[model samples]
Target chain A: MNESLFPAPAVALAQADVPVWEAVRFTAEGLVPAIAQQHDTGEVLMMAWMTRETLAETLTTGQACYWSRSRGKPWRKGETSGQRQRVLDVRLDCDGDTLLLLVDQDGAACHTGRRTCFYRAADASGTLATLTEPLVDPEVLYGPGGGHP
Target chain B: MNESLFPAPAVALAQADVPVWEAVRFTAEGLVPAIAQQHDTGEVLMMAWMTRETLAETLTTGQACYWSRSRGKPWRKGETSGQRQRVLDVRLDCDGDTLLLLVDQDGAACHTGRRTCFYRAADASGTLATLTEPLVDPEVLYGPGGGHP
Candidate 1:
């Protein structure tokens, strides 16, 4: 029904599920890289790792879910910062190796309290620019948002 | 020197170089997903794609660049619509596969002329809610500012 964005011909929405083992095929360590992008504008937010369980939960829950390599567990986005993302649509690239997720992000996507974890841009000329300011103060967003900061 | 959001100081600012051909290794398909967010408000904008050359050019040009498979070539952000994005930084995951770009965008990041590509949110009960309106008409942004009817 979303003719404007889809590949056209408007195929019926498939409820097909991507198996877990097949999903984690691309592993850097114990995790596979997952890229998060804004569903509508097509802007990329950040790249994180995801485990089998986390990926399945994300697909089932429709929230932007990821596995934290540092934490060594499945991390539902915004669990700490309250900046959650809800999945809009999920797309698999032609090769079915990389994933394209269309998400409805609640607040900042970056744990640093920035809209995205990508806050720095190193240009071809070797000029690095910080594009956006922190949307929310990290101490506070990561904190209780009450008396932490 | 930028402060590291993570504990590793200066390590985050450390620059790493990637070769062109090996730079982009998409999943099963050649389609590598990219995330886009608002430069000002820290709002997520959209996600697109980038090939090896596009990735190299993007690094060299400092512009938010991508390889549009549909258009079958490199698609520079805002090149056609005047919504150009100036690259602030680019990051790769530990896997050296996926890409993360921080950009200073000009106008609406979305072809729909919205500040970001992501204008939707999921309600508490798990329903997606579209929050904002299109900043610029898609016809205007994609075609001509005033071209489309």
Candidate 2:
């Protein structure tokens, strides 16, 4: 990935008295959507929700942290599955409601162990087709439950 | 830039009796977040909410349509600014909670007349810095009102 496209936010967040998280415009639910994309490949890995706390932590730590709405808790990437993302660049959209992260992915970003969560593509018949198979079994990633929460 | 990464959804949407929009899992608010990216460059254009009606219309017409939460109405991308997006590929994330749309953007994707909505990058101090300027003036894009709703 081109590091020059955007500066890494870790060093930046570390120095800022006024954190970048302050600029984010959270929704009524106090959440914003964050999209993580592979830095070099430009492959979008996943989309997740981030609260201000998670966003601040992510920027400061240079790791991906998100709010798991289903579990009602903070979800740290790679905490369970070891598929962590190293944040290379952080960006806010013009409206400040969305975030884009250029990341160095450790392994498959999907809980299914696929390279990306967006493996199902609309096919020539408007039917969703599975384009990629899981590289690692879910049981292998998340243990007994075999799925992420 | 490769079309082979995913098949174009336009031709596919035209043939299917069971529309792909049905596969989407909208949130409790009856909406799903749709991310538009440049099909060729992999540049993320914008993120917007989509209702079933907007999503269906988009899939069938091969154009981008969204629910304007602010306006509380259906928004055809080019309706106001002529910055339409011709959708090339449609993908659903593993959980069916998000959509990835690969599109050919007509002009600026942001109402600010930037090629993409994500133009501000977090700098070395966690402060956002504008990385790119608007290619077209906002007034030119949206008339005298000067800003999008």
Candidate 3:
């Protein structure tokens, strides 16, 4: 803990009474960064942009929904594949600019059929190393030509 | 693990033996999502955007440097607050769109003086709840008028 020398009063107050969606501070473009993590393992799976509508939908649906920046539409996780994320919890950052979603994933959280999207680690020599392999194949998950770039 | 029924070949291959910066797939804006986590605790402190220059600088300097979209300038962690991040490890996500940094945080990661930016957890009733308190005062971290919005 970084104890303050001045010992001023804490400024971060909880907005517990407010609605979850209302409490978020969305960007000017009406988007927020949302990170999904595996509920039990605590492994961060993937990150996506979410809109206020998708957020509310996620809460109501009890599943993960996000705004696809590239597709310019709402993205319901596992709609294309069977890798839906059953949201266990939703968290808002102090700044309200980011979100953390703890979820019980039905399948691989990554589109590439990996348990996690983070699989490459940089070594001391600055070389990238692949740490984990895909537990399933992308082709099997997305079908031919459905693989992500 | 959700094993594929078809069990096709893996499409995601290792981009090992390449320069760390080159392996990353930056957005059209030349930016990548960077997540900083506490090395020992595995606590995700914060998420920021990093340019290629900042990523290289971080690798070379062993310090976290991010591009401040709001300031439209380079943001070296702890430059003003003395809450520098001593990076211990760097990991790149499968799509190369996200970077995970394992770091030793010096002080509060949130400008609100909280240990982590993520402090609000949404309850079953859809109300937000503040989870963590500030470890230090924002005034002490950034001086008066330095408080974040």
Top-DockQ candidate index: 2
Model 2 residue B35 lDDT score: 92
- Candidate 3 per-residue lDDT over residues B7-29, each given as its tens digit: 11244246576778788889788
What C-alpha lDDT do the candidate models reach, one value each? 0.57, 0.81, 0.78
Off by over 4 Å in 1: A1-149, B1-24, B144-149
lDDT of 2 by residue, A1-149 (tens): 35533344333323324446777889899999999988777788899999988887887899999999989999999998988899877888888899998889998899988989987777434677666778888788899776565
Question: Per-residue lDDT for B45 in model 2?
Answer: 84
- Order by DockQ, highest first: 2, 3, 1
Poorly placed runs, candidate 2 (over 4 Å): A1-19, A123-126, B1-19, B147-149
Worst 10 residues of 2 chain A by lDDT: A7-16
TM-score for each prediction? 0.51, 0.88, 0.82
* Cα lDDT tens digits for candidate 1, B22-138: 544576656665655444344445567776667778777778778776567778777778888876556543334455655678877765566655443322232333445666677
The DockQ of each candidate is 0.08, 0.42, 0.38
How does residue B147 of candidate 1 score in lDDT?
18
Candidate 3 global lDDT: 0.78
How would you order the candidates by lDDT, starting with the best? Answer: 2, 3, 1
Model 2: lDDT of residue B119 = 76
Query: What CAPRI class is candidate 3?
Result: acceptable
